[model samples]
Structure formats: C-alpha cells, structure tokens
Target chain A: MMIKRLTNKLLMGIIIFHILALSLLPPFTFTEVKAAADSPGFIIQADWVVGKNMTPSIVFTETSGSDKTPMLRVHYEEAVIYGMKLTKQFSTPSGPVSLTLKADGPVRMSGMTVDTSSLSFKGACLRATENIPDAGLEDVTMVVHYMNAGGSNIEQLSLQTVDGNQGPAKPKKTQILVDLALLPYTQALKEVEKISSGKKPLVCDEPVADEGDVKPGEPKASIPDELSREDLVPGEEVIEDRVGKVTDPVTKVIDPATGVIEPVTGITDPITDPVKDIVKPVEKVIKPVTKPVKKVLKPVTKPVKKIVKPVTKPVKEVVKPVEEKLKPVTAPVKHALSESCKRVKDTKGKITKDLGLDLIDQALKEGKTLPELCKGDASLTRALEDFEDGLTDILGLDFIFKALGQDEEAKLKRMKETLKNQKDNFIISL
Target chain B: MEEREQEVQVRSGFSKKAFWTSLASGFLLLGLLLVSFGISGVACAVPIAGVGDFYVKFDQLEGTGYTFYPKLGETSSSDSSPQGTNLIKDVTIKNLQLYKDFKVGGDTIRVLITASKPVRITGLHHDAGLIQANAKFQNLTLKENNSSNWQKQFEQTSSKITLENAKLKTHYLFQETINMAGMKLTVEKIK
Candidate 1:
C-alpha cells in the first residue's frame, strides 16, 4: 500500500510537469525565403520530389530552421538542406532535413559571416571560385552552402517553394533563364520598394517568429511550442529602424576658419584632423607658449638676417649666375601646376584607397547590414576632393620652394603647409 | 465484544475507499489537463510563410557607394603599398546599383540588379589616394541584340584613373539610375 501511494505521487508530479512544459514551450516558426522577382517573399515547397531528369533542382529544405552551425560541423542546417536534396527527401518548415552533394562539375561553395570582410566559415567545406560554366543540364541542383546566404541583413535571398507537384520550367534547348523569375522584374522592384522599410525578410531558413506563442490568428503549422514567458513581439519601430534605415541627419561641425560648417572633416582627414574638435584648446595652450617664443625668435632672427644678408649678398650674386647655367627645368613648375591641374599625378604614393567596394561586395555576399559595411569604407571625399582641388596650389608652392633653392627638408615642410591651406580654402572652379 | 469489533471494521473499510477514490480523481484531473496543454501547444505552431506575402521590388540603387578617403594617415596601410592586383576588363556597365552607404574597406561595389549576365569583378581595393576597383567582362550580348551599342570598357589605373563622370550606352537597359539617392552616409569617426 505504501509503494502504491508513492507511485501515485510520482505520477502526479510527472503530469504536472508535462502540462507546465507544454504551456511554456515556444511556438514553432518557419522563416520563408523568397526572391521578389523570381519568387515571392518566403515560400514553402511542400512534398518536393527529385525531377524527372534524375537530377534535383532544390534538395531538402526547411522554411524555419537553423542558419547557425558550429565551425567543425557541416553547416549542419545547410548540410541537411543540401543533403536532403541530394538524398531526395521532402522537407517541412519544422522537419529535420539534411543533404550532401559532391562536385559533379566546377561548383563553388562558401560560408558567409555577418562581417562581410571576414573569411571565416562556420560549417562545411569552405570553398569559393569566381568562375562557373553555363549549365550543361537543366535539373542539376545548385546548393547554397552558406548559413547567411539569403543575406539576412541585406534582406536579399532567392528562395523557391517547389515541391513534388511543381515541375521544372518546361525544358527547352535555347531557354533563356530570364523569365524564370516569380514576379516580373519591374513589378517585383515596386514590391521591394513598398516593403524595404517596414518588413524584414526572414533569412534563409531563419525563423523570425518574434511572437513566441502561436495565437489563434497566427500561423497554424504543427510546431512544438518552446514558449518562454519573457518573449514578446518585437516592436514595429525596431523593425523599421533596421529596415527603413532613415538617414539620420548628417552631423555637421563648424569650421573655425570660415565660421561656417565645412564639409565634414576627419573621416579621412589627410591631415589626420580627428583632433579638429580639440584644435581650439590646443591652440589656446600653444598661443601662450608660442607668443613669447616668437617674440624672442623674431628679434634674434632679424639681427642675424641683417648681419648675414649684406655679407651673403655679394657671394649670392656670384653663385646666382653659376646656378643659372644649370640644366633647363621642364615645364617650369608654374606651367606644370596649371597644365596638370586638368591632368596631374599626385605624389607617387600619397593617395589613400577606401577599400569600400571590395569590402562592400564581400559584405553583401557575407550578408552584413549597410552600417556594418560602412565601417570598411573609411572615405573623406570632401577632404580628398578639396585636396585634389588644391593640387594646383600645392604644385605651385613646390615650384616656388624649388626656385628659392630651399633645402629638401624645407620643401617638404612647405608641401605640408600647402595641403593644410588647400583644406582651408579650396574652391573647385569646375 | 464481537459486535464492537464489527463496527470498527466497517469504519476502517469506509475510510480506505474514500482515500482511493480521491487519489483516482486527482490522477484523472491531471490526465485531462495534460491533454489540453498538448493540444494547445500543437495549435500554436505557426507556418512562417503564412505571415502573408510581399511582392515588392527595388527600382533604384539606394545607398552611398562608399566613404571616399582623400587622405590616409601618416602610417596608413594603403599608402606606398602595392595592394592586390588590378586586372582590367572592357565590359559595358549596365544597370549598376550602388549601396546606400560605402566604406573604406567594406561595401558593395558591384551589384548587377538587371544588367548583363556573368559580370566579373577582378579586384577592388582602396589606396591612399582614392577608391578604385577593377571589373572584367566576357562576350557580353546586349538584350536588344545591339552588340555595337557601346565602345570599349572603362579601364585606367594609377594617375589615369578617370575622375570625371562618364556614360555607357545600353541595349535594352531600362530605368534611370540614382547614385546619390535617398540614403545619406554618416561618418562619426575615422582611424
């Protein structure tokens, strides 16, 4: 009787636990990937089968599945998607799926990270090639071996919801792949414009059911609810902030020189003027020190120049003619300065490259947001363009310095000053 | 004595029955609750695609291309260093889309929204002077079948890197371009 009573108590605890677990489990969410042009937003390929060509177009796939995987594991999710397609199994929104493909042709697969410039791959064979041949067969499946291949942050993806019932675009010899898109190009673009700000495309198999529990009006798929009490529907403002990306006003800084806002400074200030903000304070500190120092130097230098000039004048005239006999300089620096303004080479190795394009491409392929990619593009266009405009001025100064027979060190100093001056007073005529 | 013992036995039996009946009812209650929770859990599973479909498209290249660096720091890596190779290509650029914001080392350079097929990017790197990238092209067939619509590709490295804007003739390219569009780039600080 005691044993029976104990058993009854144990059963009661188990029953209570089961009910509580069921209530707390979160809802099952399916993240859909759809290309607006070729495919509508997210889609489901229910009951997909291997095509008649004996090759599969889309292997096994899940609508809402894991896009994250450990580095050592085959992007297990991508692996399953491709593996299932390779094995020819139908995948569901929440069903377990896997796929494996061997290179029958020159195929490339790469793992993408949130940092576009990052070369790390979280799963599978990390491979990529710039070149790929035209399709020899119609139904050969091209696998997406990337976790973020759908470009979650960029809101870009090509998802097809094809199942067994849906057949291939009728195979043709000269079939152009242009019309295979789900929506017409222009029409799809209109759709993207309308939704670009408000909606976020659930990444490739990335479930975004911020709404944890499935309410009556919510999606009705048989997903195990892993309900957590704290999970709340994300506010629309957050989504809009990420998607709409309203350009916050460009911050402006006043230029001390002109008492007006200068094109933003220090982004790539050649002069490295991120300290422009502290320039006033620094000037204040230096003014006191420099004022007395300059006063002393000025009196000393004047006496020294007066004494040296008379003595040097007689010798300089003798040296002047000798220097004049030197080789003729090509396109006197003045002519070169003006002529080369339209065409000139900056110092052989002074220009700075933004690396923006390369990093952006990598970022897009890796699927990072614009702001993230922006970090890679450190450009000071206003500064650079102004510097370019000041090229003539710098070159003219170079010639003057050379004509004065200044030493190389003095020439370099003047060049630096010229650049600073350019930044202060550059006005592009053209 | 026998009559008293008979009364005690009848009371004990009644007490045991009451205990068993209450226990059975408790178990029955738990079982019903378990079923109800399980059913509700199943009902809450939401199909993601059922959230409704949006078939919108982007007509413009909506972003700043990249941050332009006019000057590198005294010890910038891009200065006086031979970056990656610059393999030039002579292919007409059609339907190019710039990003909303471009950066020095990261940003989208080549986005073929509705342009020719198989556009190849050879190398795109930043230098101390300005931003430069190289693209390659093969036998490009224009959509309008006008093969001779455009001239040779844009190719120039070093000082000859063209600063002025130029145009490329297109065959069946549709829509106007917006490089400086709605997107504005924000540069808070630079290294």
Candidate 2:
C-alpha cells in the first residue's frame, strides 16, 4: 500500500512536469518565395537543358483584372527560315477564303524561331482582342525554314505593341536575347578554327619537354642588345672577377680646390667605364702627368732594351712579338700603344685572366723591377688610373650606396619625424 | 485493598494511553495543516511574471541579434562572486550572455548567463557589484531600484529577457556584461 501511494505521487509529478514542458515549447513558421524583376516590362524566361541543343518556347500572359492591356509586338530587323514550311488561310466564320501554302527546304526563322517540338504557341493579341481573349501569346508565326551547314543568318529583336505604349526601348529583353547571342559565338568559333589551322594548335596529351633540352636552337625569347664575353669562358673568369669585385681598385683624389673628396669606388665589371662626372677633374689632372711620361721615356732608350730583354732569357718562350719589337716601335706610337695594351691582351688570354695591376704596382713599389723599373711602374700607374676613372664614372656613389642597404639621409630624417609623431599620438591617446 | 488498587491502576493506564494517543493524533493533525498551508501558498503565490519574451538589449535596441532565455532552475548559488544570486528560472542563452571561447589581443573571454544575479556571480573577483553597462562576458548585475520586476519574474518561472544598453565589468577570470537598460533593479521573492 505504501509503495502504491509513492508510485502514484511520482506519476502525478511526472505528469505535471510534462504538461508544463509541452505548453512552453515554441513553434516556427517560414515565409514563401516571391521574386520580382527590378525593371518593368515583358519578362521572357525559359528553362534550358545543359549538353542538349534544345530551346524552350516563351509564353506571355496578362494577369486578370489588371488595368492595362497586355500585347506582344515583334519588330523584326531581319529573318532567316530553314528546313520547314508555312501554311496560311484567311478564315471567317461568316465566309471563308482558301489560301494555299507550299513546302520548303530546311526552315530557318529569324528574329525568332518557333520549333513545333519546342514552341507551345507563337502569336500576339491583347486580352482586349475578342478573337482570343484568353490567348497570352504576343507574336505571329509568319514563316518557317531550316538551313544546311554553313548557313547565313542575321537579325535584330524588337517589339511593336498595338497600344503605342513605346517610349525608350526596354532592356528586359536580355533573357531572350541570350539565345540569339549565338550569332557572335558562331563567328568566334570560325575565327578560332582559322587560328588553329594556321598556327600550332595547343595539344593536351603531349608531355612537356624539359626547358633545358628545348633551349638550344630555340630562338632566344629575350636577346639583350649586348652579348657578354663572360658567357664564353665562365669557369676561367669566375674567380678573378670575384676578387676584382671585392677589392677596392680606385684611389679617390680630393681636389683641394673643390673641398670635396671624390671617393674611389670599385668597378662592378673590370671592363665597364668609371663614373665620369665625379672623376672628370681628377682624370684631367692625372692624364697629362702619366701618358706622356710613358710614351717619351719608353721610346728614347727602351726600343733597344725591349728588343734585347726578351732574348736575355732563352727559356722565356717568346711567342710572336720577339723579333718584331723595334719595327713596331719605329712603326709609330700606335704600335707601342697596342703592344702595351696589356688590358686588352689579358682579356684575350681567357675571358677571366686578371691583368693583376695591383701585383704590378707592388712589384714597382718594392723595386723588384729594377731593370725595367720605369716601364713597369709607368704601366702600373696607367692601369691603376684607368681603373680608378672607370669605377668613378660607372658606379655612382649615391646609387650604389642605396643598393647596398643604406637609406637616403632625407628618408632617415622623415622616419625620425614619423616616430616622434607616433609618440605624440600615443600620449594624446592616454 | 489489592482489588481496589488494581482498579485504580487500570483506570490510570487507560487514561494515560488515551491522553498519549490523543496528543499524538493532535500533533499529526497540526503537521498536516501546516503542510497544506505551505502547499497552497506555493500554488497561489504566483511565480514571478513579466513579458514572455523579456530581454534587455544593449547598444542597438534591435540589431544585437542576441536573445537570453533564463533557466532559473539551473542556477548554481555561490557566495563568493558578487553576482552569485541569480533569479533566472529556465532557459539557455546564445550570444547575449554565453559566447564562443575566443581570444582578442592577449586576453581570453568566456561568458555565460546563468540564473545567477550579476551582483552574486561566484568565482568572479570583481570589487564593484556592477561592471560596465554592456559587459561582454560573464554574469553581470543590473542596477538597483528598478520599477519593473523583470528580475523578479525571471527568478520564478523563466522568461526570455532581451537586454540592451548594458555595460561590461571585468572579473578575476572573466568579464561580465551588465544589463543597464534602466538605472535600477529590485530584489523580489520568486516562486
């Protein structure tokens, strides 16, 4: 009896709890679909099947009890009919006149096409028209035809309402105009076919050739105006070029008159000329002192010395200029100029042969070339000066400094100012 | 004399038993009356009542897109935190009080609107009873002295309170957003 009473109480509590819960639960409802075009006019819509070449007919309807009369007017700019025929007869309930229509080849209808398989109906009449008061169609089906391959067709889409309700031509025709846009697509496809036949068509299945193998004999996609000799002897020149790049070759001379020191910079390339604007004054002063001393002193006594010097050492391996030295000196200063053109000769030895102008300078300064001290030292000075001039002229200090990770002084000042402004902004925020 | 004594003892026994039984029955009857009184008080006292979908929204009145349904039954009472005494009855909240665990800058914010009052929120180490008017995290306290008994009705059965124009208070582990739609809140005895 006690257990029964307890069970009844528990059941009552559960029932009360469930009843409260059921009353408290909320319900939900969803709204229905309604879409309207932003523009006002006749709307032509169709459902098209993908991968299948078929068109659905357009149907127009006038809503009931609407104040305005609905009509469809077709203004055809052009029309083409193919592979079909048309039949027409004027029929009157009071009296009838018989009209005969003939069969044609493939019917092609332009401006619009009404495929009997695709079209539901094609004609135009307002709801006000008593003949077909309920008929919603707006355009007439005048003629039909079909076309063979490579057929000519062109047309424009327009409308003429019986009500003269025309103003600016409405552009809501975009829905129907899309199917007619095939005119441009057909033209473009023809152009693509022509292009493919004339040029190498892109092949999807062919494996891509390695860029390295396809490189040779392939016309260079980009040809520089100048070809680098470094390309010919890349291995031989790599080291000397690397050393020349690192070592400071130019000795900058400050003209006391200008109060500006022209810092000697190294030439990026041994062949490129030095910057001219910065080194012009220094070059003008140094050239007169160096060139004449080389020419006059070299010829007055060394013609005989140059002739005998190569012979003194039999193992010295005289190449071509052994015996012809005096004749060349006598030939003119031009011959001596070419003979002493060690810069050019060294370049010819290998693309990278270092002329070692620095070593030559050390040899002259150490008095190691005591026998030909004048010639060796003079050649060294000329080579060193030329290198200095080349560096000064080719590599602008301002430009190089920027490239080597240094900021412009003005930019640094601006950055400082910006930092100060940010500090002030932070204080204002606080 | 023995027989006379026996009769007196028997009369005394009967009287004693009768008195004891009467007293016991009387006490039981009093207890039943008290229990009935309590049950009727609970049945007729009326659970806190207010708007069915009562909510105080902060900032934008309508656009916060937050709805708080108070589940007063699920309240966990704690004496430590200021907003520990919550009167909310039965409901779960999304966005209005509880938020997804997320990090903003270098701080982690986790907030939930339990049935606990903002002033009695336990585990929160906030000095002020009320945090910011629109505290984004944790249970926040409404101001005292309010005419509308939303807090009262909420404590009894549950109702969805849409709170707007609230501020947030920073607590030890989290911050609490308080509904300050009005200036005052009052305490009421809920069913």
Candidate 3:
C-alpha cells in the first residue's frame, strides 16, 4: 500500500511536470525553429546579445502558401546597404570587401555559431530583419548609415554578418514541414512515426515555377526584349513565382503521381497552400501528443480518466472562484486604458500648443506660410546676434503624460524615440 | 531495594530529558548552519562572508597598478613591512572592500588600478634569506621617482624586503606600472 501510494504520487507529479514543461517548451522551440529557418530563401538570423538589448529577432515567416515559402524581412531603417541585394538570394556577388579590421571588427562571422559578434545596443540599434529582401544568396554587408531627424544621410560605421562561404549553404529542398534543430527533441512522436511506421517525413514538394514557367533546369523560351542586367538581378525576379513556392496561383495542378508541383506552362489556376503559417500552431499541439499519447495514453489515460473525473470537478470548482476574482480586474484595466489614452491626447495637445507651430502648420497647409514669411528673415537675423537665439529652448515634456500611470515608462520611451527618430511622422508633427 | 528502584526511575527520566534536549539542539544547529551558508534550500550565487580581517590588496605594492584596487577586506594594507617574505598563505580573495597604504621610507608609490577581478595568490612565504622574484609585464611603462630612489631602496633592504639593484629600480624608480588590475605579478623573491 505504501509503494502504491508512492507510485501514485510520482505519477501525479510527473503529469503536472509534463504539463508545465510542455507548456513552457513550445515558445522556445517555436522561436528557435523560426530563428533558424531552414528554407533557402530565409536567412536564419541568430542574435548573440551580450547585454540586455531589445534587439529585433530575425523571423522566417511564410507569407501565404501553406507555410511553405519563407520570406526573409530585413528592415533596418537607419542603415544603408553598400552591397545591394540585387538577387532574390541576398548575395554579395561583387563589391569592395574590407573584411579585416581592429579586434572589435565591424563585421563578424563564425562557423555555425554567432560569437565575436557582440553588436548590441540599449534598444533595437542593429540591423533589423523585417525588411531584408527574401533572396537566396547567403552573405551581404550591412553598413548602418546614421541619419539626422532632418533626413540627411551621413557616413556611419558599417557592420556585416560573416560570409556564407564559411559554412555549407543551406541545402535546397522542399519546404520544411518541421524545423530540424527542434528535431530528435520536439516532435519526437512525429519522428517516431517516420521511424516506426516507415512514414516519410512531411515535405511540401510543390514545384515553384519561375521565369515564364521555366521549370528547374529548363531555360526560359522567350526572354523579355528589353531585359537589362539590373533587371536580371535576382530580386527583380518574379515575386509571382517566388511567392508561388508557398502558393501556386497559376499551376493549381499538382502532379498526383510525384506529389510535386507539375511543370504545366501557362496554367493560370491559382491555389492557396492550405498549410501556410499553420504548421507550428497545429504541430505544437500534435507533436507533443504524437509520442506521449501513443505510449502514455494506454497506461496514463486509463488512470487519467479515473483521476480526471475527480480532478475535473475540483478544477472546475477552483476555476469558479478564480473567475470571480478576475471579474473585477477587467474593470480596472479598462479604466486605466481609457485614462492613459486621455492623458496621451492631453499631452499631445500641450506639446503642440507649446511649440506655437499650430497656427504655422495651419497656414502652411493652406499653401501660404512661415518660412515664406521669413524672406526678410535675414533682416531680423541681423538684429539677433545669432539666429538660434531667436528660438526658445524646447522643454517641459516630463509632466506631459503623468497620468499614464502604469504605461508612463513605455509611453515616455516611445515619445523619446519619436522625438529622436522623428520617424512615423509623429515627431515631426509634434 | 526500594531506593534502588527510585534511582532507576530517576536515571530513566534524566536519559529521556537528555534525548529531547539533544534533538532540539540538533535542529537549532542545523538552522545555524543554513544561516551561515545563506541557504534555506535555495542558495545565493555568491557566498557572503562575515566582516573579517582578511582582505585582498592589489594596490598596496607601489608598482601594483590601479588607483583603487577593489577593497576586499575590513582593513587595508598597513605601512608595516612584511616581516617575512611569505606575506600571504592560503587566502581566498572574496573581492570584498579593502583599504591599504604602501610606503617605503615614508614615500608613497604610484598604483595602477584594474576594475576587472582580483588574482588569487597562495603559499607566499619567503624560503631563505633571499626572496627571489620573477614577474611578467605586459604593456609595462617605466617612470622615474621625482624625489629619491636611494632612501626608498634603503627602507626596502632594511625591512628584509630584498629588491635587486635593478628590480628594485624597476619597481621603485624605473618601474613599469601596468595600467590594468587583472594582471598579477608573482613575487618569487619573497615567496
């Protein structure tokens, strides 16, 4: 009886442990899988952060076609690329290469590891991955051009990722049904199915037609009469075909025999890849159970059903009180949100009024205004020792959003960024 | 026979009292041990030491680099000379706060400070009359003492702190001061 009690406790502990572990496990597994996107077009971005940096994560997102096509987004706003990504592959075919530098070199590359690249900032200062051209080539140099809020691009230090030549180019393959690094660990059940039941691994073998329906190894029959070398750059390649890898609008015909996209020329039937962006969400649930359900279900569920009957009622009973406790929480949150928004608006009004530019802007929009009024500005400029003396110091913003309460820090930070970057036009308007 | 029976009862009562007292004491001792360790099941990353006399001084030695080597002990190095060459033995540098003054013949020496970490020294004892010292210097700079190297050298020899004519000059007069704190010079002559 003692041994039976011990086993019972152990089983329950394991169930709880598994539930907690499984819940915590998915995000890391998912982000990691997304970070190291296996698709050739998607450059797997791993940020090796040295400090507490709010660095942007490099995500490989399939825009549409059934989660098959991975698009690399590199959106670094305050940067200029010297080696333009002319191709869809984001390659540096040829450019002036100054690879070596001081111990703290601008560019860093490690084979299969991101070390020695200690580029991080207090905020998202490094190259953003949201706007990078989703091309196939492996390496490109990123020269972050610092620009003033006044829209003048200035020469800033350049930073580059290590060359792709250091490691094997990601093997060209069909869309990855499952992330490989998460393999042998996550989705153990799915792997077991492949091994145990001789099931083939999941792959989207859809043929992505490009260049006037040119199949792989098939030359384009009729090139555009006015094709320039610049146009031949991979990026200019048809977004239609590139996007087709995920969803083939033209060739809806899947060669049933090969389970691949058929090389049907000029077929205009469009079809959406059913699995687009849905793999991880669905697989996150399915993969955990895939193994445990088969093994654990037989033994565990028999006991689980027995235990769950008793446990379910208590859980339901416990949930009722939690719901009662949480019901009041919504009222405060709503009240706080309404209060903060009001404060933000009030502060905005104060800033605009203090700037004394409201009347100036209204005049400018009506097509007659201030800078024009300053045609004799030099006459007044002569009276002032310096033109800067005429302008008063900008101040008194700290008290603007005091009522933001909980959101004060974040809102203040956003206001600071807006004033600094003057991007999204909010700062300029202020 | 009745008295003997009473005596037996008294001894049994005393043994029971002793057992309970010892059990309570055991628990109290365990709690104290946990307190000293700073662990109540969960432990802090660094074990904090009680305020003590021990300290690690990297700045006391004249050529030792750093304006303020992190104070590691309750007290700093005193003006007193090392009576013996083995100044340190089996000491763990907790990187605690410390203060010390190093003077040769009432003359102060320049110090190089490193904010990084403290180097651990062990078994620093003078073997014989001669304290042999060997050290490696990186990015070392030498500067002449503005006042006098002779008086400083005199104080060094008198304290049994034997600095060779050249090494003494290297340390005091023509000394190369490392601007870093992490670098440690192992005093082989004294130890």
Model no. 1, DockQ: 0.01
Give the lDDT ranking, best first: 2, 3, 1
lDDT of 3 by residue, B119-158 (tens): 2332222111111222211111111111112111100010
**Candidate 1 on B34-97: residue-level lDDT in tens?**
3453334221211111111111122222111111111111112222221111222111222333
Number of clashing residue pairs in every model?
65, 92, 46
Per-model TM against the reference: 0.16, 0.10, 0.16
Model-by-model lDDT, in order?
A: 0.26, 0.27, 0.26
Which candidate's TM-score is highest? 1
Judged by TM-score relative to the true structure, which candidate is superior, 1 or 2?
Answer: 1
Which sections of candidate 1 miss by over 4 Å? A1-22, A26-380, A383-430, B1-191
Model 1, position A48, has a per-residue lDDT of 18
* Decreasing TM-score order of the candidates: 1, 3, 2
DockQ of each: 0.01, 0.01, 0.01
Worst 10 residues of 3 chain A by lDDT: A109-118
